[model samples]
Structure formats: structure tokens, C-alpha cells
Target chain A: MSVSALSRPSFSRRALLILLSVLLIALVVGMEQLAPLFRALFPDQDPAMYERESFLNLTLAHLALVLVSSLISVSVGVAAGLFVTRPAGREFEPLVSTLAAIGQTFPPAAVLAIVVPVAGFGFIPTLVALVLYGLLPVVQNTVAGLGTVPSQTLEAARGNGMSAWQILWRIELPLAMRVIIAGVRVSVIINIGTATIGSTVGAKTLGTPIIAGLVGNNLPYVIQGAILVGLLAIVTDLAFERLERRFSFGESGAMA
Target chain B: MSASHNPTRDTASARLVANRVLVTLLCAGLLAAWLLPFATMSPNRLASGQTVGLSEALSAWQAIALLALSAVLAVAALRRPLPRELAHGVVLLASLGLLLITLYSLGDYAQRTLVEKSPSARVSQGSAFWVMAFCCALAAIDAFQRASSGWLLRLGYMLIAGGSVAMLFASGHFDDLSIMREYANIRDNFSDQFITHLVLVGSALGPALLIGVPLGLLAHRHVRLQGTLFSVLNFFQTIPSIALFALLVAPLSALGNAFPLLGEWGIKGIGAAPAIIALVMYALLPVVRNTYAGLKGVPPATVEAARGMGMTARQVLWRVEIPLALPVMLSGLRIVTVQAIGLTVVAALIGAGGLGAFIFQGLGQYAIDLVLLGAIPTIVLAVIADFTLQMLVVLSKPAGTRR
Candidate 1:
């Protein structure tokens, strides 16, 4: 309980960033070196397919989808979580929980099929499904986080004459921020992984090359898709580690 | 007056009555709405534009009977503190009933000659049916556990309620199985491929449990290693499965190619083994994180007492720490497995034989039916795995879990 790491120098964060950037650089270098070999091997396939086309488009699309949907999902999930968790709105809690749980329990690919006719294929539907599938962790975490917020802190907020809204925005959210962040981190990571499936349905993302390569049995193309994805995931994860540190309490330092 | 503490007997009674009524109404409303498409006087004739034929009526009746049986089981759940064996029996019967209903419903839907015109009987065999049934089962389980009577009996009530919904659909499908010759999915000779899917899933669990459990245990014991272990594993998990599948291809293939002997035994570096290895990597974070968190969560005094009694470090961990951490580790395993099953689709890219092949196969061929054949089984396996793990988690909980 006494493990306050706040007094630590900020330089460690710079160190972390450098460490992560170097990792990224290394991957890029590796890819650059392999480019010639890959081209030599796949003269028949489009040369730029590995370079400017699949890898970059996939990573960007993945980042964009995850970034937008995570923001929307977390905002809505946290808000709904706050609303439904109140004593007066308690009964709705079960319904929300059920919906959230079910949303995740079903396969997103199957869900994509169901959503396709309704939402159409490609970006929006896949994005929407990702948002829905990603909603549970943040919302559940919010509910549980707020639930576990110290009673004394809540009482202090009330004693200070903060309105319910203020208490939530100021006292509760901040205290629960770490937990909520943990939830968001989980959602973000899962979304990164799940985003690959978007290609199977033709979103023009990185998964397309992977899926296409799989079907065609092209090893270099497959490696091109996979390496980029794995690299992006690692990079994005490192970014989150930094973000979590800046906003969260003392535990952020411990988190990485 | 503090409302939670307004302990007057009359107040408790009134509250109980109100709750019971609400539960009943909500349960009925949801269940009925879910089944509404099935309950028509005339059956839906998707193929012929005809009303439900008489034969369809018979299946519908059986569905209704099955539903009633489920409801009756829920009612019986009102009976208190069910005997240990009886509780197990009810769970089994309800499960059996649900299975029977699905088999029957599948039969009816699959059978072109079955003369069933009602979509209700057939609908329960699909996605909506699964969703509705799962919801009902949850509600029943909640109500049963929370019932004013014994905990076991309350749980039984819930099981019965859920079981009935599942049965209605299952039996509805099963009875019509004989008629379903035309729409049969794949000539999936269940001998090898089925075993392959199971094996892939099973093997993924191998490295997962092996790597995850030790890391979990080690991270739990060593404070210094915790952050590094957690971050590394978390980073490992953050990589999307699709990417991981693709990423491992060349290196593994290169290794296999470099070493001639490795390539022959299905170890030619790139496909199945790499897929399994990557799947294991994907599954590791949850196990380790949960195990670490679970172990760290052990009461400080408990560990202190174990040490005071001159217990060796090994003794303390094996005897005290693990028993307590079992639930968390098991849950972690569950998450890993469900995740592995779903993510296994990525393996298809590498010729790691799996159901994903059909899904991707369908995608390429533009065959919707083939996609469903692959996707449906994966979903079912995920759900089934989730529930089985849930049962394990519930059963393994330390107190008030003997039921």
C-alpha cells in the first residue's frame, strides 16, 4: 500500500520510449533487408505489394479503426456504466451486463456476417462490430472500478458538496482511472488482434494480404503481413504503457 | 431508516413477493418474445410459401412440451436445499433435454421432407436461438441462486428455466434430423479433421498451460520479476493473432528449411507447429497475469502463518498458494482456451489445419454456406468451452461452492 512511485524522475519514460522506438527501428531494418530477398522470391507477384501496399495500408487501417472505436466505446461504455450502476438504475445493470457479456461471447467473425447484410461490408460494419465487441471490458471495468472506489474518498467528495456528476467526473473517475485504464488497455490490445479479421471480409487492411497469402500459399506475402502486424501491436502496446503512466496514479510506474 | 436495514418481517415478505413477481414476469416476457416466431397457428413455409403443415404442428407440440418440462423443472427448483446428487441430476437432465431439443430442431430444419413450416421450431437452431437461450439460462441461474429457499434449490430453479429453453430448441431440431439430407454441410468425415480441430485446441492448451502456469507461479513468487513478466506477456498478447500467424511463417520455415530433418515430420517450419507455437504465445498472458494476480491476492497472514510453522517455500506454495490461486488460474485458462479457439482461424494462413480453412475457403469461393459450416463450429466450441470453464470456476470456488 505504501508503494508510491511518484517521486521518481521522468527520465525513465524517455528511456522506455527510446527502447520501444529502437525495437520499431529494428523491425523496419529487418523488413528493408528482406525486401530484396522477398522480391527475388516473388517476381511473379506485385513487388510493391509487400512494400507500400499491404503492410502500410493494413497498419494504418488497423490503427485508425482501433483508435476511433476505442475512444467511442470507452466513452459510451463508461457513461453507461456510471448511469446503470446507480441504486435507482440497479435493475438495468443486469440487462446491460447481459448484453455486454453476450456481445463478447459470440465470435466477432460470425457477428460480422450478421452485421454485413445490415451494416454492409468493409470499414463501418467491421468498425461497429469491433466497437461492440470491445465495449465489455471497459464498461465492466468501469462498473467494477467505481464499485471498488474507496468509500472514504466518496464520502469526502460528498462532504465537500460535490454534486453526483462532479463526484463522478472528479473524485470517482480519477480514483477509478487506473482500473478504467487497465480495462481500456485490455480492450485496445484485443481490438488490435481482432482487427486482423476485418481483412477476411474485405476491408483492404493488412489481414487481406495475410488471408490472401494463406489461400495462395505464398510464404513471403504471409510473412510480410504477419511481421507488420506483430510489430504494430508491439508498438501500440508500448504507446499505451506510456499513456497509462502519464494519467494514472502511482501504480502506472509499476504497470510496465 | 436505512433501507437495507429496514428489517421488519412484513417488509421482507412484501419485498420478496414483489421480487418474485418481477422475476417471473421478466422471465416470461423475455422467453415468450424469444419464442414468438415459433408459436404461430400456421407455420412459416420458407420454401413452399405454405402454412405450417400438420407434421410441423407435432414438432411444435413437442417443443412446447419440452418448454413446459423446463418450466416445471424451474418450479421444482423452488424446493429447497436439493440433495447433492439431485442437484447434479437436475443439471444433467436439463442439459440432456437441451441437447435433445437441438438435435430434433436441427433434424427438422435440415430435413427437406419433414413438412415443417414453422420457422419458430427451426429458428432456435441458429444464432438468435443461442442468444435467447443463453440469456434465459443466466436469468434462471441468478434467480435460482437468489431464491428465498436453499441456495442449491434456487440454482436448480435457474438451471431448469434455462434448460427448458435450450431443450425446446434442441428437441425441435433433433426430431427432424432424419429428414435433413439435402442441406448437410460438409462430408466432414469426423474421423480425422474433427480430431484435428480438437487436437489443435488441445495442443495450444499444452504450451499455454505449461508456459502460463510456471510464469504465473514464478511471477507470483518473485516481486522483482513481476513487472517484466507482466509487460512482456502483455506485449506478447497485444500482437494481433493474424499478424502473429503471418509473422512466424518465414522464421519457422527458415529454421525447418535450414535443418532438413525438421521439415519432414510436418515440422517443415512454417505451418502447423508455428501456428501451435504462436497460439500458445497468444494464450500465455492471461494465464500468467491471472496466476500472478491470484497468488499475490493470497492473504498476507496466511503466508506468514505458513512460514511461522517452518513450512518450506515449496510447501507453502504447493499447499497454500496454489489451492487459493486455483480459481484464478482456471479462469485464465478458460479465457486462453476460448481465445485460442477463436484466434485459431489465423492458423489457416499457414496450412495449420483447422475449421478456419472452410471459412477462408468459403470467403475465396464466395460460398456463404461453407463459411457458416466453419464459423458455426468455432462459435459453438468457444461457447461450449466457456460454459465448461465457468462450471469449473464455480465448482472450484472455495466457499459455498460444494454444490
Candidate 2:
């Protein structure tokens, strides 16, 4: 709460990361006013855009799709990983892994093809495909993270008379938390990229501009979409990195 | 370990239950195949039409043959203390045979029914047949995984299976299936798409390595630069392939215009230039990250020792560092290659002419088989690239590090 604390190295770094991201978003949303400059760059082509959706709206929609699907996938993936690692669920480990692998091998495009017919187009199919695509990394990392928790630590906890649930909640998961977060980080970043494909099925993401540009051969629309999505990804990634650093530093400090 | 795995304890009681379970699954799969539709007789590719069950689609003998194979697999499963290798072998044969038979019958059924219908009428393999084939393939892959075969052997099995299917094509068996019909329609364009897809992948990889390796070296040699470089590369990577393709269009077109020679070299806003450029951008993160990691993994003691031995820095890098780093770098390359193959499909959306052309065309027409024609090949390409590169990684690993 102190001004001195705010001046600390980590706090300043965190502030910088957030500030940069906000500025990037502001630039992207204001890109329409910069159309003249863009037109100057690509002088041979018409500067007009056919993209009906504004950059801001598409960016928000893309983020919403990513947020929803990522939440669902993380829960499902983490839960599945936790279950398989449990003594009672050990037998299903291979089954869980195999299913996740199968989910991944089927491409998002193919997933779209299959889902669109059954679920129809727009948000639902896109969400379904994103969830499927995102599930594998989260599950893989969760399982790997939990599995790699030093058995000696668990044994010590058990010796202290902690119940299995208490051991998992207070001990195992805390220690495995960083790795699990890394998994979620990878999954979310991947979803951010994959979610653009949603525009193909009319879910209205940043891909709207890209696809529209491709169709119209309007180069600037494509540039605007690409810049926004790219910046969003960078911001999200930087935010995750900052969080990871804080966790590692705080956890180590606590342990020491 | 040997003493604990007593012959009866390992096999007798649990094996009996497992065998019964396996047999039941096989029987159930067989029942589904027989009772459900094997092919659909559509008036056209877009129209949903009548479903033809296995018996109606295949000649009686062929239908009986499929039934017999599943039954035989069930009976084989019933054998106690079955050799693991034998179980895998039987599953492999049965599944491969099932796939071949289904493809043959698909063509045959189409020829029989569609010959009497309008020329535009299409006959495609239906849901039941796909389910049946998937069941068989899953069973086969499961058994293969359990069998613990070498990677080379597994790849060999795949080649043999694919070759047999190719032989069927040569023998004119698949000429009537709707997928084949589509292939025949676009046979000329198919090769061009295939070549473009390969070129896109190769072009992306070539520049990625050139740029990524040095960037990785720079990141490695300098600590402060690592995060900035990686975050930038990572940001580019996280942008969707479609978005990346879009992002490149304006700048590249501008660059091409500013320098007319660039335009002459075919560096316009859209097409191969943008697609390849986007792919290369995507390709950079993995290659750079891996190269850095690989170089970092070179033991500091080894470097120190090399320097102590009067070796120049360059000599140490080439002789000690690179040799040690080769395997990890190859593994990184493997990831990039697989990722690029999949991403290249998206590039096709930008008139770059890859498998995505068929996928988009199929999407526009709502033709599932046409989409599969594109989707399946892309998946195959990715899988093959993944597997082959994985093998190279394993082979390239230093002997001491071999697992």
C-alpha cells in the first residue's frame, strides 16, 4: 500500500508491461484515423475497407471467445489431469491421454467442418473447436506438473497426518502451481491464435478484417487486423510472463 | 521382476477377463457396422441422400468377409495368454483389411447405384462406414502402442498400409467413390496445390533457420536481449495464421511498390509472398527458442575445457557446442516443420494455393468429402513431418545421451 512499495523493481516492471499493452490497444482501436498514412504506404491500391465490423468490436469478440473457451478448457483439462493422477483414477490415465491426443491431431479446420454441420455456424462451433484444440496442452501440462511433484514432499506431508485432500490442496498443488500456470499460459496463447479462425464461420473476431481484406484485396484492413491481434497476443504473453515471475519470486521467498 | 510376473499370476485370471472384454468390444463394433449405413447415395455432393447399410452397399461375399474378420478378431481375443506381439499383429491386419474392404465397397456401391442415376449424382461413404473404419484404426493404433514396436517398424507398417491403398487406386478400385470422383475432377490442380504446399513449407523453413539461428545466438550471447527478442517472436507466433497473413499484406505490398524489382520478384500483398513470409515469421519463435536452448545446454565446463585446450572460440562453437546442440536443434526444427505444415493450410485462404483451396471450396459448397480431401491430406502431411523429424532427433542425439 506504500508509495515506497510501488517503487519496488517488480511493481515498476508490472506497471510498465500493463502501460505498454494499454497503449498498444489504444493505437489499434484508433487505427481508422491512421487510414491516410496506410493509404500512403499502399498507394497503388484503393484505401477503402469492406470490413463491416470495427477493429474494436472484433478485438473484443475475439477476446471473449478466447476467455470463455480457455476457462472451460482449463477447468476440464485440470480436472481431468487431477482425476487421472488420483489413485482411483490411475487406470484411466492412458485413456485420458489418448483422448486428448486425438483431440489435438484433428485440426481446427476439420473440427470446424464437423462441428458447423452439426452445431451450425457462428460462436458455438468456434467455441467447440477452440476448446478441443486448447485442451491438450493444458491437460498435458497439468498431468506432467502434478506427476513431477517430488514424492518426498508428498511423503513428508502425509507423515504430518494431512489427509489426501489437504495434501493436494495445501501442498502438492501449491508446489505444482507454477508449472500448471505455464500450461494454462501455453493453452491460452494457442487459443488466441486459433480463435481468429472463428471468423471463417462468422463468429466475428479480428480475423474479420483479415478475411475481409483477403476478399476485397484491401491490404490495410488486413494490416489493421493483424496488428491488433499481434499486439493483443504480445500483451497477454507479457502479462503472463510477469505473473510467472511474481509467482516464482514470491514462492521461493516464502520457501526460504 | 521375472519372479513376480509368474506365468499364471500374470496371465490366467485377469487375462481371461481382458480377453472377454476385448471380444465384446469387437462384437459390438461388428454389429454397428452391419446394422448401420456404410455409404450414402446423394443426388449431388451437397444434398443429403439415402443411407445404404453394409449389406446393401457391398456384395454379399464382401459383407460376409467383413463380418468374418471381426468374428475372427473376437475369437483371437478369446485366446488366453496370447502373445502381446500377436495381439497387435492381428489387430493391425484386421484393421488394415477392414479399411481396404470399406474403400473398395464404397466405390463399388457408388458405381452400382449412381450408374443408373443422373451423371451429377454423387455417392459418398457414410457415417457408419467412417465409424467402422475409425473403430478399426483406433483398435489397431491402441494395439500398436501396446506392442512397443520400434519407430521405424511402425512407420514401415504405415507405408505398407498406404502402399496397398495406392495399389487399389492403380487397380481401379476407388474410381467410383465420391472422393475419387472429386479427385478426378481436379487432378490437374492437385499436383500444383501439392507443389505449392511443399514450396511454402520449404521456403518458410529456409529463411526461418537463417534468421532464427542467428537471432537465437544473439539472444543466447546476451541476457538482456533474450526476453525482448523472445517476447517479440512469441508475440508474432501467437497471432493467428490468418491474422499473420493479413498483417503482412499491406507492408509487403508497400515494400514491393517502393522497390519495383521486389514486385517483379513476385512480392505482392497477397499470394505466395505473404503466405511464405507469415509462415517464416511463425517458424522463427520455435527455431530461435530451440537454438538458444540447445546452445545454452552445452555444458559450461565443456566450453571452459575447450578454451583451456587452446581452442579458439569459433573452433569451440563449431566442434564442441554445435555437436552437442545438434539433437536439440533438430527437435526444435521438428516442431517448427510440423507447425508450419499445419499453418500453411491457413495460408491457402489467401490465394496462396495450397490444400486449403479444396478445404475452402468444400466449405463453400458444404461438401464434407471435399473438405476431407483437403483436411485429411493436411493432417497426413503434419503427422508424417512430425514422425519423420522425431526420428531424426532421436538419431541425431549424442550416443551418451541416447535413452
Candidate 3:
């Protein structure tokens, strides 16, 4: 009975996840077909649909930016976190942690604005901003995750004649993988939201329509953009939830 | 023992033991100051500027003096025989000096180069100047962190640094700088928008706490309601702020149309109404989650003891549970407050007037200083909010719980 109770909910959640993903793609691809509906909703506006860029193309570009930036952030942030935790690099730990904490307090919009002057407005500048802003969560989590590894476990690994590298790879990393992935999840989610604002600076993302609509005072375009972006965020968040659950399950199964 | 006997070897080893963080930051600052443009001179606000190198920005002797001071600080950081406190003191003072000298030189250069040439001519901080400033701030912060564990002392040091800069500004030393010029142009609007930003944040926070805390208490009491409550709040949180604000426009406008009285009260498609509503929605999750977690985190034994002492559930909750949960709940408030402050800047995009108006306007006009005028204060406000709330969280800890 207990097994069935758990399994049934898992099945439904997977179904919901797939359902949302399908709905998101359908909305992106067929946004114009729903033009009449939008026109009805927003009766007076001409060009009720956002058509300067294809929603499909915009979605892809948005995802690509988030992926590239999150990739760079995770790699650099995780490495920095690891470096500062090791014995050779321990003295720098406080500085790195303090930086991570303080960096998060700077608003993403401000960071993007500052980057424009130095890097100018475009994909590269937006990517730079997203990576820098997304970094704090990953670094903080990496440090926190690695710190959770028990001293006894490290001692045992050392007693077995394992090299520091071997222990880190074998014992420490696996133990910390769940937390690190949680960080990545947060970074990716934030990057998705932030990437929308990138459209303000000239990077083609879903926010393009919203900014354009706001400027033009067209409600339909704003709605179209907002709906698609909202869908994407919800879909991504649900996917991460599944991923986190899988990792935790695997961790427990390994112990068993 | 043998190394101590050999003074030369001891000194060599001492040289190897450098304060890596300070040395690295100082060296980077030096290289950036030497290589990057120290300032820019623009003919007008709209036009891009000509880059001026450090030597051109300052007199020969002044440039050398600044470099000499930085080099001395780096050497002081490297020598192990120097006392740690002394090294930190030297680093703090020298970095502060570098910061002051850099700013003074920019103003001096601007006065000499632009004041007579064109009244509208602007002097902006160049890449090198920004990099140098950033490096100095970080190095000074590191020194402060190392020099004192006490918050009061660290705050005192910060005040000394910040006060000096404020004094310099007050003295009109930076009058020729572009950002200051922008401030002069929009002085009235800047203050008005600044107040609006604070008002927006406060309005949203007030409603969020009122709704969220009770919901949190309900969730804590009822095991079954917790999941649904959190999921709903989390769903709201997952939407991007821009998207959330935009999404509210249609429905809100419809409401305003359906009820003209609501429209009269400023409940419209785009403005503070939707902006505050969306902010409150975004804020609810943190407050609710934190409050629930705080309440649930109270020790079962303590709750039992309270009951055993003939205390009613209400008394136990009010007197014991609330006090114990205060710190964690305040931490949640900290996150909510800071997040709201940042989000308020984005609200300006929707016509919810705030510092973001300057930011967006600057972005529109390609005026970097105008952007700075907006972005800098938003960051400062967020940082100040974060620091103050962190102190609150620390202070709220019950006597035995203080760290």
C-alpha cells in the first residue's frame, strides 16, 4: 500500500512535467494562431501578436544563453569553491565566502547596466552579466556542500592510503553532489529569469516583446511575451525538481 | 632553530610568506591603473569620450607618488615579520589614500581640461579608474575583516572611509564628474523617485508580512496544509519579476475598467498598483517559508516544558515559540526586504516611479552616468538593508542563542 502510494504520485508528477513541457512548446510554436483570441482580449491593438522575432527562435536563443552562462558559472564557481576549501588554499576561504555573500546583494539589473559601459550592449555583455550574477549561488552551495562531508569519512579514506585527489573524487564529491546540483538548479533558474531582461540590452530573448510592448504601450505583445516566459520558467523549475528528487533517491539507495 | 640562527635564510623564508589575498589585489590594482585609461573627456553628455591615460590625468610626481604608496603597501603585506594588525592598518590607510588620490586627480584633471573648454563637457570615470576603485574597496574590506572581529569596529572603519568620500563630494571636488552633473540636472526628480522607491518597497512589504505570517502560522499548525501552501507560493516565486509584472497588466486593467472607482484609486494596468501587487506576491514565499521553518524549528522539549509548567498553548506560542523563532523569521524578512528593494528598480519599467526611472532613461539615452545615478543608489540601498537586517537577526537571538 505504501509503495503504491509513493509510486502513484511519482507517475502523476512525471505526467504533469511532460504535459507542461508540451504546452510550452505548443505555445511558442503556435502563438500566432491564438492571435484572434488575443485580439478579442485586447480589442483595439493592431498586431496583437509579437511577430518581429519568431517565438520559437526567441525561446531557443533564450535557452541557449542560459545554458552557456550557467555552464560557465557552474564550472568556475565550483572550482573556486573547491580551491578555497582545500588545505593548500584554505587561507583564502573567508575572502571567497565573503565575496560570494556580498556579490549576491548587488541587483542583477544594476550589474547588467554597469556591464554595458565596459562591454557594450549585446549577447556577450548579457552573458557576462548572467554568469557573474549566477555565480554566487553555485559558489556558496559548493562550499557548503563540501563542508558537510564528515571528518571521519576523510580520515577513513586517508587511512586506506587514498590520495587527496582520490578521496575528493571518490568520497567527497559523491557525498556533496546533491547540494551542488541544487546550486546549479538555482543558478539555472535565476539565469532564465535574468536572461529575459537581456532583451533590454539587445540580446534577443523572450523579454524582447515585453520591453517593446511596454515602450509601444501595446498590452497584447506584453501578454504574449509574459505568458511564454512564465511558461518557460515554470517548466524549468519543475524539471529541476524532478532532477533533485532523482539525485536524493540515488543517494539514499547507494547507502542502502 | 637552525633557520632562526641563519638570519638571511629566515628573512628569505619570511618574504615567501605573503598575505596572498592582499598582494594579489594590490598588484592587480597597480597593473590596471598603469594600463587602463584613467578617465574620459567627452565634449557633451551624448557623445562618447576620449580616453585619458593615468599619466595624462595626473602630474608626473603625483602619478609616481600614488604608485609608490601602492608598492609599499604590497611589500608590507609580503613581509612576515610585520605584525598582522599593523599590516591590515597599513593596507586600509594606503587603499583609502589611493582611492582619495584617484578621485582628486580625476576632478583636478577635469577642471584643468574641460571647465574652461566647454561648460557642457563631461569627465567620466574610465575603465582603469573603475577597476582601481573596485580593487581598493575590496582590499580595504579584506583588511577590515582581518583587523577586527567586532561589528562596531568594522562599522567605524567603514564610516571613516565612506565619510571621507562623502566629504569630498560635499566639497564639490567631483562637480566636474559626469555622474555628479547628471545628479545636478535631476536633483529634484532624483529625490522624488528615491522616496517613491522606498514607498513601493514599504507598501509591498507591509501587505506581504501581514498575509504571510498568518499563513505561515497556519501551515505550521496543520501538517496537511503545508505542502499546498508552499507550492502555491513557490509557483508565484518561480515567475520572473518582469514577466510577473507584465502578466498582471491585462487583468488589472480589466479590473480598473470594470470598476471606475478602482481606477480612480490608481489601480491600473501599468503603474505602482500592479508593481506592488506583484512584489507582494514574490515576497510571500520567503516570509511564509521562513516563518514556518522558524516555528517548526523550536525544540519539542522546550514546548513540552512550557506545557508542563501549566502554560496554555497560546501562552507557550506567544512567550516561548515567538521569541525563539524571531531570529530565523527576521532573516527571512531580510531576504524579502532586499529582494523587494531590487525588484522595485524593475518596477520602474512598468511606470512605478523609482530610481529605476533614471536607469531606464540612461539606458535609453546611452548615458552611462545617468545609469550610474540610478544603479549605484539601488545597490547602496540594498546593501544597507541587508546589513541592517543581518544585525537585527543577530540581535534577535534569545540570550542563550547568541553566537
Candidate 4:
């Protein structure tokens, strides 16, 4: 029953996904063409579009930042999660889990702000902040997902003469993949939002226009930036939904 | 059975010989103290400071005493079987002592050297101090975890440590520090901003609970509604908080313009209204999801038993289901409250007066201390909210179900 449900992409969802993607692309590519509309809305503001950098360039930059940071966060987070769960490193589990929980209580903005004093400004600090903030969800989910794998299954694999490494690679990881992917999805979405704030520290992202707009009180510019960012988030979320469903085999029900 | 137990006992004894986590942390702290600068002494607030090593910051005897205390901590951790509680006690006390001594010395150094030289001279904590402080905190937390399973014990420790720090602040020991100077400068409005931040969180939370609980209850009653409701809420959650705040500007302003009364009622584009609305929207997913899950989690048998006892549907829900679900629902509330506290900081971008105003203001002026002025309080608030709600969740567990 679940297998068939996983295979098919429902029509409305598929259409909505494509439609959002198209809209995002159109806005990115043709933001300038909407200037008259923006001007109509905000007559007091001159040059109603955010013209310092094109929307396409900003969107690409935003995605690139999130991509690099998410990649690093996932690998490092997953490694730490795996390490603490193993017999040789099991003693560190309490500390690692505690740190992950406490670290997340910090707001991402404050994390970014604090990093500035030590790492200085620009891309590296932004990257460091992103990875730091993004690490928590992935580590937590990886640990949680791996823990859900039954001990009996591990013993069964051992009975079949599989090495510890083989059991982890072939059985444990596959079983935990869905939860791990869900974590990655959350990390990516958070990074997308956080990357916008990266613009404040001189790492250019879609937030540039919005920040500039807020500072300058340019309503049109704010709207344009907000529209693109909102679309990107929705589109990315939909993509993850599809990916999560694909990995949902064997699980009784989908996790929200 | 004796033969099988022998190996397990041997391993347990081996484990007692060394706590590798604490040993590693102590070593790292010591290394950071030895290798990096302990503090920076700047002539004035704007100019960058020269780094001062631990040897420079404190006299040789004081530095040695500090290092000796750290070594004692490491040794105590290694001798884990010296009455397990005593070992943990030593670790905890040593770490706390190290922290207090380091800060006190730094403050003493700042008072005697920097402030005497120039009234405006600033002493900023350096990388080494931060690293040492972090290590001490983690070590203390680890020791506390090992020391007891009771929340009350942990709470006692927290209160002692927190009270000591508060007393230190009251005594003006850290007034020479740059961050403290920033605080002294903003002391007047600081409380106001802090109150504003709390108000913002409360405002958002009140509406969220009011709306989200019913939505969740509705979703629970109708399986079909659950799917659609969750999907819509999830969609709202996906939108970045910043973007959502900005996005609301257009329609909100238009609404205010159309109805002048809303503008008069403080429903403008770039203020508390949009910020609160976005926060409530972001909060709904956790609130609604948890409520629905909590209600659904009530065992059918329990509900049936309630009905069999001559209870009506409403009575069964209020008496049986809601009580059973309280913990889960409170956990969700915990998430919402913590998240709102953090998001409210970002709402400062939209001219909502809060601690984030200080943060952004400091960012604009390139003042790290000013940024800390805002960021520190924000973190403390979030942590407090998280801890308190976690306790509430634990307490809310139906008495029979609680561990």
C-alpha cells in the first residue's frame, strides 16, 4: 500500500511545484520588467526595482552559500552523530547530545553576530555561522534515526557473518536514511533562510535588497526580494517532500 | 553466570579508571590558557586592543594556582572511583573555581592596569578566555549530569552559579570590561528593551495558542482536514521569517491605508503587527502538530473506558484525553515560545522595538560589545524559556505516567 503511494506524484502537487518553479525563474530573470507595476504601487519611490544587483545573480549566490554550508554541516554532523553512537565513543553521547540541544537554543542571528568578533566579516564568517547553526538538526536527527534501528536487526546481521562495517553500511544506514534525509531537508531550508541574513555581513544573498529596502524605506524593493525568497523556500520545500517520500519505504507512516 | 559476569565487571572497572571526555576537555582548556591571549587591553573603545597573555594578565603565582586547579580537576576525573559522588563534586567545584578565579583575575587586572591608565580604556575578553570559559562550562555540565539524576539538584546548581554571577555584576567587578561598559552606556533603555522583547514574545504566543489549539483540535477530529491543514501550515513554516515579515508589509500597509483605523490601532507594515503575525504563523506548525499528535496519542481504550463510565464525549475529552496529552502539547508550546523569542530578535529589523534593536544598532556601528549587549540577553531569555518549559513538560506528565 505504501509502495504505490510513494511511487506516484499526485497531479495537483506536481503542477503546483512546477508552477512555483516557473514563477521563481520568471521573477529572477525578469524583475526589471515589473518596475512599472512596483512604481504604480509605490509612487513616491524612484527606480522602484532593486537594481544594484540582479535578482538572478542574488538567487544563485544565495543557493551557492546554502549548498556549501549544508554540504559541510551534513557530513560533519552525520560523522559526529555516528561517532558518539559507536561502542568506542559511546561515552561522549551525553555531552554531544547536550551540546546539540543547547547550541540550538541560540538564535541564528546571534550566532552570526557573535562569530563576527572572532572570525571577522564576509563569506568565511557567514559560512562558519551557517554550518554551526545547521549542524544541530542534522546531528540530532542522525542520532535519532540511527537509534531507531532495532538491536535485533544488528544481531541478525552479525549472525549472517557480516562485519560491523558491513552491517552499518548495508543495513543501519539504509534503515536510517529516511530520517537522515528529513534532517537534511530541515537543514537546507533553514540555511536558505539564514543565508538571506548573510547579506548583512557582506556575503551577498537575496536579503541584500530587503535589507536595503528596509533601511531606505523602499517598499517596492522589499516586496521584490521577499517574493523571490518566499518562492525559493516553497520550491525547495516541495522538492524535499518528493525526496522524503521516495525514501519512505518500510516505514509505517510518514513523519511530519 | 559468574564467568560471564567477570568480563563485564572488568570492563566496568576499566571504565572507572578514566573519564576520557573530561580529561580531553581539561587538556584543551589548559592548552588554550597557555597558548592564546587571555584578554585584550585597548586604549579606547573604538581602537583595536593589544592581546595580553595569561602571564601578562595575572601574576605568576595566580596563574600557577589557576593551572593547578585545572590539573586537579583532570586528576579527579581520572580517579573516578574515589567515591563517585566525591569525584564528580571535585570536578564541578574545580571547574567553577577555575571560572571564578579567571574572571576575577581579569577584572582585577583591568582595574589595576587599564582603568588606572585611562578611564576609557577597555578590557575585552580574548579567545583564550572564551575557550577556557566554554571548557569550564561544558565540564561543569558534564559533572552535573554524572552527579545526579534529579532535576532539583541541577536546578540548585544552576541557581548557585547564576546567583554568584549576578552578585559579581552587582559588585561592579566587570564594569571595566567592554561589554559591561556597553551595558552601562545603555543601562537606561536596556530594561525597556528587555521588557519590549518579553512583551513581543508574549503577544505572539497568546494569539498562537488561542488560534493554534482549536485548529489542532479540528485537525484531530477530521482526518481529511488534518492533511490539508498541516500542508498549509507547513507551507507557511517554509517561508523564511525575514521574508514573511517583509512580505506582510505590502498587504498590511494597504489595509492600513484603506482603513485608517487600523493604522491608528498600530497595525502598520513595519512594526509589531507584521512581526507578531509572522511569528504566530511560524508558531502554528509546532503548536498544531503537537496538539493533534497529543490528542491522537490518547489510547482508544482509555477513551472507551471513559465513555463506559457514563461520561459524555466532551467529558471524555476533557477528563481523559486532554490530561493525557498535556505533556506533548506543553512540549510543543515550549518549541513555540523558544522559537518566538529568537524570531522576535529578527523582528527588530522591521522597527519593532526589542533587544534586536541594540544588535542591529551595534552591527551598524561596528561595535562588538554592543552586539553582545543584545545577543547575550537574547540567549539568556531563550535558554530560560526552554528550561522552564522543559520542566513544565516534565511536571505536566500525568502523575501515573511520569517517571
Best by DockQ: 4
Candidate 1 chain B minimal-lDDT segment of 10 residues: B39-48
lDDT tens digits by residue: candidate 4, A1-256: 4655534434467688999999999989999999888888789898798999989899999989999999999999999999887776676888888998988889888888888888877888889999999999899989989999998888788889988789889998888888899999988998888888777777899999999999999888888998899999999998888787677765555643
What are the runs in model 1 whose C-alpha is more than 4 Å off? Answer: A1-14, A18-34, A40-56, A98-110, A113-120, A250-255, B1-187, B299-304, B307-311, B394-403
DockQ of 1: 0.40
Sorted by DockQ (best first), the order is: 4, 3, 1, 2
Docking model 4 quality class: medium
Residues B113-231, candidate 1, lDDT per residue (tens digit)?
43544433232233334433454455444333333245455456446644754665455444443112112435554235556777888998997888888887887667778666776
CA shift of A106, model 4, Å: 0.6
User: Better model by DockQ, 1 or 3?
Assistant: 3
For candidate 2, report its TM-score. Answer: 0.87
lDDT of 2 by residue, B250-345 (tens): 678778978999999999877899998888988898899889999999999999999999999899989999888888899889888878888888
Which residue segments of model 2 deviate by more than 4 Å? A1-13, A24-51, A54-56, A88-107, A113-120, A246-256, B1-16, B19-37, B71-81, B304-311, B400-403
TM-score of 4: 0.95
Kindly list the per-residue Cα lDDT of model 2 for residues A1-256, writing each as its tens digit: 3445434645655776788788777876677778778777667667554347677777789999999999999999999899878754553566567766655655566666566654667899889888888888889878888887887887788779888889889987877777788888888887887778777777888887777777777777777777788778777876876666555524432110
What DockQ class does candidate 2 belong to? acceptable
Give the DockQ (2 decimals) of all models: 0.40, 0.34, 0.49, 0.56
**Lowest summed-lDDT stretch of 10 residues in model 3 chain A?**
A247-256
